[model samples]
Each structure stands twice: as structure tokens, then as C-alpha cells.
Target: MKASTISLIIHGVDVDVVYKKVKYLRIGVYPPLGQVRVSAPTRFGHEQVRLAVIERLPWILRQREHFQTVERQSRREMVSGESHVVFGAAHRLQVIEQPGRERVEADADHLLLFVQAGSTPEHRLALLERWLREQLRQAVIALIAVWEQRLQVTVPQWTIRQMKTRWGSCNPQTRRISFNSELARKPPHCLEYIVVHEMAHYFHDGHGDGFTGFMDSHLPDWRSQRRELNKR
Candidate 1:
């Protein structure tokens, strides 16, 4: 069964339609932005694919709405009353001006930032970024340890960094995984999903049947979590 791919536009959304040697049609909406992709039998023509997308247009719009309403929040000013997310919970930020160590503390409803008086917004942002990075790193490390034992694979290294397009990535040859720093702002389960997804790559490099099967066996609700993560 040979495979080929092409692109088309439906209702103003760019779509990637893949012709594969398969039995049924499958469609998916992916993130950072909602990218619509369809997989159809090689026998299906472009018109068939376009009609399928048209049938799912409502669902596609809903998925895009989730990304816009949840994941694409307004720019942060890092000031009091600003909304911040931690562990999937929304918290209001409270900046406390004090001549002490710059740090962050969080309770159920507030992310308190203690900074010196007259600190610039840039300085405040830097402090928050460092704290978020540390938080993400700790979460990634703990998850890696757990998955490594379960998957029976030794990860040589892993790091948390800003990624514009991916939630996480793996280099199986190097046994290293890199997580997006933004995971700190998403729900805990989302972070866990990315960790396990990357670790699964240790056994399966691509998102083919083998990898999908492995994920289903390990995390039954992975698809749900993945949708939520992309919405963040």
C-alpha cells in the first residue's frame, strides 16, 4: 500500500489530506494551532476527502475554539490580578514589594511573587520564568523516573525548554527527551501525558500502530489528555 500527501483548504482552514492504503477514513485536528489532517484510502479521490472534512466542519470548529479560548490567553503583564496557570488550576497573581529574596509562592488561589521595590516588569518576568522552569524541570524529572522503570529504558538525559511547535520530543539514539517549558502552565495530567508519550518513543520512534498500541496499553485515557493538553 503506497502513501502520498497533499494540501487543500476547507472553510478557510488549511488541511493536509493523506492518501494511504487503508480501509477507512480518519481525521485529526492537531495543535499549536488547529491543523486539520485526514487519512483516507488510496481509492478515495480529493473530492471524497473534501466532503469528509465538510461533514466534520462543526467538530473541527469546536476544536479550534478550545485552542483559542483556553490555550491562547492574552499576553501576561506579570502584575497583580493577572491570571496565571499552575498545575492546570487558574490562580491570580499578587506581587508583593519587599527587599528580600525574589521568590514565588502559591496557595490554592494565588501565585504570590515577592520582589524588591521598584523592580521593572522585565525583572519580574525573569523571576517568574526562572521559577516556572524550575517547576517544570522537577515535574519532568519525577515523571521520567517513573516511566523509565515502567518502560525498562534508561534515558541518558532530559531537559525542559521553550518549544514553539511541540509538547515534547525524543531522540531515541541518544536516549534523551526534551519537554516544553509551557507544560508548567498546563494541567498535571497533560504534563504526565507528554512525559509518557516521549518515553514511549524509547520503544517506538514514530506515531504508528506500534506506538499507538503502546500508549493505549499504558495510558488508556491518553487521547483525552492529549486533547486537553492541546487546548491549553
Candidate 2:
């Protein structure tokens, strides 16, 4: 059955309540920003769900604090000496103001941003994001080639966007997929795992046994990669 959802504000935090046919209530804090979600048995009312969230309030607050720390890390100032992530490694940013078109370049431990002398932070960010998108695109294309054949599915189209709460999503009917641009900041393996994961959705709709089996058969270490990718 499809779960019914209700939205609530508890102690200044937004909570999404999903009523499911389960015996117990489950709570989770998700990322990009701290989003609290609760899975409650269908028999429970909204009051019961609220109480459940209050009972676990401390733990939820801690989890939200962790996500805030991660958010601050991702929100950069676009200046020299600022720490930035590229391909899962921390790279210090160096803004080199010059006379040409703005471009982003990086070595093993540093990101060299060449701007037009007086570029604003927004302009620098735009340049960096443009570069990151191309990086993610090339990686996705190569991975899709291998995965489409292995999974026996064709991805008619795919896109990269700034998703606040999801690493990736897919439309099985359209045979199209979308990946989070944030994946560019993660390891290559993480991106590969997401590609295979979304592609597998063409066969299975949810994370049920069918999807689990598919992932297990194809990528045995997917759980580890998931943990790494979810880590801030």
C-alpha cells in the first residue's frame, strides 16, 4: 500500500510523517539539510507521531546538528585558502585573478581558480559549478556505457542538478535519470554506484528484496559506498 504523509512542525524543526503498515515508529534525519521523517504505524494518529518525535528529540537534535556542520562545510566563501572538496579530497582554494575567461583548475591538493581580476563570489561559484558539471557528466557517460549494457537497459536521457535531499532519482517509464551535482564532490566509485543504482530502478521500483538482490549481485560493496557517500 502507498504510505500517506503528513507534515508537522515540532520544536521548530520540520517533520514528515509517513504512515505505514508497520508495528513500530521509525525516525530518520536526512541530509543536504537536516530533514526529519518519521514512519509510524497506520493505526497511530498524528498525536502519537508527535509524541514519538518528542521522545526522541535529543537524538534528532544531535543528528540535525551534524548535518548543519556538513552544510557549513559545503557552503564555501569562494576565496583563497578556503577548503573545498573535489573528488572526495579536501583541496585548498586559490583564487588567481588574471585577464582571461574565468576557469577552474585543480591539482592534487589545490583548486586554482583563475578569475577576471574582480570576479565576485557568485561568478567564481558559477565557474566552479560549470566545471564540476562537466566533470560529473563525463564520468556519468562512461559509467552509463558500462552499466546500461550490464543492466540491459537504455537511459534515454539523464541530467545533473543541485538536489537538496536526494543523491539521485529516476523515472523508469521515461528511462531517464537525474543525479545530484554534489556527486562531483564525492569519490568516483560513489558516482558509479549511483548510476548503477538508478539504472537498476528500470527493473525494480523500490528498495525491496528485488532491488536489494540486484544491487548485491552487481555491486557487493554498495552498502559501504553508500555510507561513504552519505558521510559529510
Candidate 3:
């Protein structure tokens, strides 16, 4: 069956409406900007979909508020002696300036960033981002190895990159995953849940009953992990 798309504005909120061959209506609020999306049966008219959105107005607003809170807490300022998160632990960043190769080392409580002398803030931030990507890489590699054995599916490739909203995404078609580098700043368990969630897509493509069942059976604590991960 073919699908159609349309835009909507309810109570000053922008929504994306998708009409498809579905049994019922479904609404979702995505991260980054709390994008509102509605999926409805093609049989439903525009007014019917609008009424459904109106009925769920309060719930939609609440979800948007939650997204805003998470965003504010995730903001980072790359500087010395600033608090940074790695592997779910808080570490103070110690920026060291010297005429040496730029590198980063981490101990229990500190991230020692050795940078070339007289580096700009942008340069420092870029170096830190690169380091964070590497950190996420190592962690993801270890987690994927364990999950591949348990789930019995191999991931061909994965990349760590900055994402505005999602923690991770899977392109099952390509057998590749894109992980949010910011996960390095979140709790370790939270990162684990994201990895598992994305890998589950190898079997289930959407957040439907099948996907939920897959997650519940494999990572029973995923719901709690998601709640904690969304907390400010």
C-alpha cells in the first residue's frame, strides 16, 4: 500500500502526519526538537487525525518538556577543570598545554588532554570530540562483541558521530549502526541499552510489540535505563 504525508499545526506545535495502511492511529514525539509525528490509517480523514492529535495535546506537551530538560543538561563546554563524563563516571578535565603531540589520557577522576601550546577553544573542542569518539568506539566494540554472541547477529560496521537527538540508529539494510558520541558522557548502562536497542532492530524494525518483546526478553531493565537516560 502507498503512503501519504502532510504537515499539521496544533496548539502552535508542528506535526508530521503520515497516512498508511494501518489498523489504528499512532503518535510519536521524537527528540532534539520534540518532533510530533502521527501515523494513521489511510481511511481516516484529515479532521479525524487532527482530532486525535488534539485529544493527546497534554501528553504531547509533556514529552516536549522532557526533551527540553534533557537537552539543557547535555550541553558541554570544553575547558580545563570542567566536569566531563566518561563511561558513566564524572571526571574533571585537565587541559595541559605543551609543545607535544596532542593526545588524551584518562584516569579514575581526570581526563588529561595534552594539546599543542596556544590552542584555540575550537581546536581544543575538536580534539576532545575526536578523543570522545575513540572512547565510544572502544566501548561500543566491546559491547557489540558480547551482544553479537547473545543475539546471534553480527554488525558489519558502526560509526561514532555527534547526533542531535537519537542515541543510536541502525541501518539494517547496510548492516551498519550509527552511535551518538555523546553516549560517552552518559551512564555506562544507558549506553548498553542504546546498543541493545539498536541491535534489536536487526530482527524488529519498529517500536512495535515485536520490538518491545525483544527488548523485554533480552534487556529487561531497558525501560528503567531509558528513564534514567532521559533524566536531566
Candidate 4:
């Protein structure tokens, strides 16, 4: 019997199922988890593949729900009582009202945020974000110096900015690395791992076996730090 392909709409999203060679039916979704792809062997017809995907539909819905929950949780916009990351540690800001200038200072524990007596919450948040970025810049430079020596690589330029998704990115062609400014709020090891990861890219452009080997040899805990960074 000749196998056929089919397409169907699941949860208002279109999914295409294909029949290929030498494989049992398999279903998986991409990052946002709203769509599923089904692949099956030539011996199996599209109907069978569709049924398998239908069976797994509940699991897919659960995965999508989980993704949405996490996404909502990760979008912290710097409000009072909202947690901010510093050196990978979660710190809640203590918003203090002041009579004059807006200022930010850190004590042995929490970040002390002071704003002009009449200043609004928005102003205070902006001031704090600026201070955080400055701290991040200093820390990034320090980490770069350490890794340049440790990895025996030279990075010509680097920038720290707030990135919505990725913690860091590197341009191997230009020897420039850009790190998410929010990293300053995370743990020190997280910063180090990101710096090292970008530095490693200076040597290996792709995340292949060579890249993994290089990272493993240089920083054995790199994987753990990466996991922790993402978990937050």
C-alpha cells in the first residue's frame, strides 16, 4: 500500500504530517509549542500518523500551557517589590521615598533605592535600571579580562544591553560579544559562564562537538551554570 501525507488544524494551528522512510511515527513541537510535526515511515499511512498525533494532543496542550506560564513569569519590568537579578541572585528592590535627588545604593544585603520625594515609581525604576547597567558594565569588563587570559583569546569589542530572550550573543566574525545587561543581576558564575561561552565562540563558531569539547575542557561546570542561568 502506498502511504500518503495529510494536513490538519490543531487548536486553530495548522500541522503537516509527512510519511517518510524507515521510521515509526514521532511527534514534537518547537519552542513556542503551539505546533506539532509528525513523521512516519513509508509503510505507515497518513491516517495512522494523524491518529498518533491526536493521541499525543493532550500532552502538547499541557506543554504549551507550561511555556506560557514560564514566559509570563520571566517578563520582569522593574517595578516595586518586583525581583531583580544581581549576579544571578534574586534581590527584591526596597523602594524608599526621599526629599531630593534620586539615588541608588547597595548595603550588605538589599539594593537601597531612594527617589526624590515627589518622584513617581517610573522615575525610580529608570534610575535603578541605569545604576544596574553601570554595575553590569564593570563586571562584564572584569570577566572579559579573566577569560581572555584563561581562554587565550582576544575580544576586540563588547556591549552590554537588555536582551529579551538570549542572555548573550557573539559575533565571531568581528570578535565582538554582547551580553544581556540583566546578567548583572544574576550570579557571578552565570556571568563567568556567559563570558567564557562567548570567548569560546571566538574559536568555534558553531555548537558542534568541538565546541562542546572546548567548553568541557575549559569549564567543567559550564553546563550547570548554563542550566541555572536559564532556569531563572
RMSD of 1: 5.0
Q: What is the C-alpha RMSD of each candidate to the true structure, in Å?
A: 5.0, 4.0, 5.2, 7.9
TM-score of each: 0.75, 0.79, 0.75, 0.67
Tens-place lDDT digits, model 1, residues 197-223: 988988886566777789999999999
Which has the greatest TM-score?
Answer: 2
* Predicted candidate 2 versus true structure: per-residue lDDT over 124-144, tens digit per residue: 998998998998999999999
Best by lDDT: 2
Score residue 107 of candidate 2 by CA lDDT: 89
**For candidate 4, lDDT tens digit of each residue in 2-110?**
3334567755545656555545677765433244556677777556766777788888778657766765666545446766666655677787776876788875457
Compared with the true structure, the alpha-carbon lDDT of candidate 4 equals 0.72
Error of 4 at 32 (Å): 12
lDDT of 3 by residue, 1-232 (tens): 4566677888788888887779999999886547688999989999999899999999999998888787777656667878887867889999899886998899999999998887887788788878888888888999999999999999998998867556788887997899988788788899999999999989986566677889999999999998887555
In model 1, state the lDDT of residue 133. 89
User: Which 10-residue span in candidate 4 carries the lowest summed lDDT?
Assistant: 28-37
lDDT of each: 0.84, 0.86, 0.85, 0.72
Candidate 3 regions with alpha-carbon error over 4 angstroms:
1-77
lDDT of 4 at 88: 55
Runs off by more than 4 Å, candidate 2: 1-23, 35-73
Q: Which residue pairs come into collision in candidate 4?
A: 85-185, 86-185, 87-185, 87-186, 87-187, 88-185, 88-186, 88-187
TM-score: the better of candidates 2 and 3: 2
